[model samples]
Target: MSAPYAIPRSHADWRAMAESQSFETRAFIDDAFVDAASGETFETINPATGKVLARVASCDAADAEVAVHHARAAFDRGDWSRIAPGRRKKLLLRLADLMETHKHELALLDTLDMGKPVSSSLGDMAGAIACLRYNAESIDKVYGEVAPTGEDSLGLVLREPLGVVASIVPWNFPLMMTAWKIAPALAAGNSVILKPSEKSPLSALRLAQLAKEAGLPQGVFQVLPGFGHTVGKALALSMDVNCLAFTGSTAVGKQLMQYAGQSNLKRVYLECGGKSPNIVFADCKDLDAVAENAAAAIFHNQGEVCIAGSRLLVENAIREDFIERVLKAAEGMQPGDPLNPDSFMGAIVDQTQYQRILGYIRQGVEEGAHLRSGGESVETCPGGLFISPTIFDNVTPEMVIGREEVFGPVLSVFGFDTEEEAIRMANDSLYGLAAGLWSQDIDRIMRVTRRLESGQVYVNNWAGGDMTVPFGGVKQSGNGRDKSMHSLQEYSELKTVWMSLTS
Candidate 1:
């Protein structure tokens, strides 16, 4: 279904929305919006204007204890877990409908809170809504299985919900990531406590209320908006939390796993950092298409994407021509005011990420990598955290910029002579999240894709997949899948029951 709200085209209109927009600044627990137990709050800033958006509740250990208590109680009481799959499906469907109705409001929250373009924020809303709907529809369709057994015996394999799930999501794609974690978890009848990134929690807070309105049971879903050191750690260390689903940096994912091992040995599913490689061969059918896709692979969402194709490996025969085309494409994506629907690129998520990206650019220059284009901040929007799409050429695989995940609109280009060399360079990193390959020869495509050490590979295109496919990574990128039917398994447990019918 199409988005129901009319997008505001002008900057003035969006500015007005920002001025009049009401925010949910409290924690959502036990079906109510309340302040943190310690009554502490933290400010969420709009990177575009460097202005305070709202003071969200800064939940700590005490607040996490309370939320987890309620969540466990709700799950044990079977308020939701014991409900019929059809009933859960209906409620989730209602929540999706509510989200669709408030699509513009939710989109505005992300735009104002984290500085993505309003248009892209709207697109995020659509994707989030679709994810919710897909999981909701799958609720009743998922069925148990009967195993082959002796004539007098019966064996049944059933999928059951884990008790309590703590979902820690990142700020880059706040609502979308939140939906990705919670939709299937909730659909499977698990009680969920969401810890959204302190930088972007408004959309998640609002989503909790919508879920409540959609008839989710008390404590079935909760939102705790706070820092990772306090609320997030508490949830991770809680013995009562049955599973933890997280999406963020690789370092944080490792920490969460440690916490899980130290506490309940709860299931930990993570989708973390990526420095995906986009390789273009000499036999590419269209240089222009590949260049355009290459620009978007790194520049989309200001390149805050975890699976962004930040490393470009082009065959030497076509490196010069392809690089020129890519530079022209990057030139068209200059940073602009996020509220303007015409704008493609927006401000960085916050000042911290902005500084982090700049540091990487400086490191690239200091390391002798050639800065081909855009390694400076844009001054068009004064006080805005905007960075130009930066490109660095002659980047050796060992350089810091080439190895680490900058997580910004920075592209590093490398030239390779042979297919083996391209594959080797692409797989040199610790991350194996996603990769892109541009080649016209079918045999070469099959041969190269099999050798790439990545979870997902896009051939002849970039980032070309949908909800039907699984999204996750290997190695340091983390061990979890987010979309499609496979993700449901992460939040569920399998059980076998045997019965003997000897009369």
Candidate 2:
């Protein structure tokens, strides 16, 4: 669309790169790519240019059954599931190594499948590698517990792998989210069935090939790409799956929980939606830095991040000045060709999401929120679904745009009178995934950090830090954590073993 910076690479370069290799389409099951049981395939479109990338296998309930059965059989045989923790770690590390070696290609595929800049996709690839390596390295260090007991008796607490795990990840950050679930699950020595969103299934399919190249056993890891109403529901309803780990909408998470209950009552771990708050005080110093970060938090990845700081809670004393700073910061982030490394943002993922984001903007205007900056279409990118970064000021907590998850580059500004009021407004939302606090006062930082209802809190910056820390949400944002040692427990089942020592 509109790129503020001069193109670092030509459009012809992208065409050449895209023509160099073919993206995978078939489902990977039982250690190989295969047709779906129904023999149907769906076309996965390139969001950046609106071209069909590949015909991904359209797996449904029947294919899900086939995958689950194979997984169950694999788990039952104990070929991989009963392997030593060190051995599994070794295999996973090898997979991580392979991922890093092919990083550029993986990054390109991700950018092509979903409308995100190549630079951003590379970061996602790096994050995925980090997640896998971290999980792989931690398994051998973690140990089962020896409980205290009388001298005559002994108590042992053993951590055992769940037999079969179904991992459902969202379209945004596909590879990274997949690794978040698969790495820990594999480290725990369980069979995994990965269900990537149909909209962006290319990278997951390619990763399955790499997993095989790394020598993961047959039926140990499988990828089924399909619509949620069909294969996703099938996985949820299956009685054989021991656990279901998901990252997506709060509504879908709730529905999956219900399905889990209706079936085997499998353990459900969810990392869902958020309208995370970024609170800035009339700080002692640096409004410029805070303003810059505030804009980036919502504009990055076209605001697809579940923990994006969509709601900006600014102190009343500095609200007007901060909004101007934020507007200036947003000017450089225009929608452009995702293939270019210099591009800050790209097109929307698809028409459905494109329309949804515009609808939310319309809702904001109707509710009387003042349009602050770019909210119009990017006419330069005709075929692509490109939108300029949109910001709304004078937003109340009760407005539709203020309450809902727009999942686009849309920011809502809310002014607060005091520290207590800022905290109150930040905690008012049902979602509690993440939040940020900015202040020079150490006392205010400590107090607000302690009082915040979020699962993860960032001080002085928005979404700071890395994969080593735990991530997830509380309340309506969903249950359980991801991306740390805590995630390992999600795929494991603890058994307390008691034995008598007789003389």
Candidate 3:
């Protein structure tokens, strides 16, 4: 079937439609959009067009206190946190349905706010809706444990909601990341306060309106839009916030952890940055497929994904041929207007990200890595933040481009001689969020899968999965899982119940 909404074709059309759409810019509290306590505001711009979308309230520590107080009151008063699990599931399902109904609007907002391709944003919206619905359906199915005891005693375990949750999402996948955290938390019967990245906050505010329409109670879900250092730190340090979930850089994640310990000792769940490795063995059935997946992995969302396969590790025998094919595939991906459906790549989130990516490219040059494909920004599209797909070959494990998370359309290729060496190279990084392996040999694939230290591994493909599988990472990539039943446990607390009777 065709998509419900047609993609905007021209820059003029996009600007006309986007400028006419009214958006709310205040902090969401008690089921309403309101300004921050300090009345401070910041401008939200459309990265694709560089136009001001709205003036969002700049929430500070005081605004966070208000939001958290309302959330705590809602939780303690049994409005949401103390509700029946089944009812909470129903509400979550309704919320998902509402999101699905407005998928096109959310997709447009996402593209305008974050400068991702509209078609990709549409798909992400659908995935986010499905994720929420799936989590809601699973809420009532998760069961607690019953411990076996002596004949005279009985022990029962119950799962209860963790009171108030604070979620901080990144700019790359704004609405989807929000749903990733919001769905499970709400389904588990917890009231939440969300803080979206300052770079992109439009979709998050729109989500607040959708949540309200889904019949979520006042104070059950709140959104505070502002700089991370101000409002985000407040959420991290708030004693009333029982749990915190964040997706961003490792440096900020460490700061959040420290803040959690300093104030509340809250449970912090982080899905930090990653420099994922996509390994291609010489025995792969199709080099063309490997190259295609390689391009999509790095080029998708302009390479802002935390799990993007930025590090391409190929077998020494196929290094030359594979690089040629990958370069050919990358030529087809051109960064342009995000609103155009034909455009596979789009702008960076903002000017800061654009400059950051440029700086990294310059670093790759300075560090002596061979720039094989693209390494410069496009000057024709001056208004939009555009960077060509960059590939660095002959990259050692020690180079900055090979080690750090560039978070742009940058790929570093490293050649390995043997299976053991390939596995060693893949597991050498501190971040092990996700990895991919391309090979036709069953034995070698099995051996590599068992030895790889990543949390999620894709075999012969780029990205695939839904709410059925657990999504998380090992080591410095962060703790706790999202999606599936495993994610539900993060928002729930266990309680032991014992009963004895003598009649």
| lDDT string, candidate 3, 288-338, tens digits | 978999999999999999999999999999999999999999999978788
Candidate 3 or 1, higher TM-score: 1
lDDT tens digits, residue span 245-346, model 1 = 999999999999999999989999999999999999998877988899999999999999999999999999989999999999998888888988888899
Task: Using lDDT, rank the candidates from best to worst.
Answer: 1, 2, 3
**Candidate 3: minimum summed lDDT over ten consecutive residues — where?**
1-10
Each prediction's RMSD to truth: 1.5, 3.7, 2.1
Off by over 4 Å in 2: 1-14
Error of 2 at 275 (Å): 0.6
Best by TM-score: 1
- Computed on alpha carbons, the lDDT of every model, listed in order, comes to 0.93, 0.90, 0.89
Per-residue CA lDDT of candidate 2, range 1-503, in tens? 23222323565666567677588889998988998889899988888778888888999999999999999999988889888889998999999998988877787788888888888988999999999999999998888899899899899998999999999999889899999999999998899999999989999999999999999989999999999999999999999999999999999999999999999999999999999999999974988888989999999999888998999999999999999999999998988888877888987889899899999999999999999997777854658888899999999999999989999999999999999999999999999999999999999999999999999999988877776788999989989889888898788889999999987
Consecutive 10-residue window with the lowest summed lDDT within model 2 = 1-10
Query: What ranges in model 3 sit over 4 Å off?
Result: 1-16
Clashing pairs in 1: none
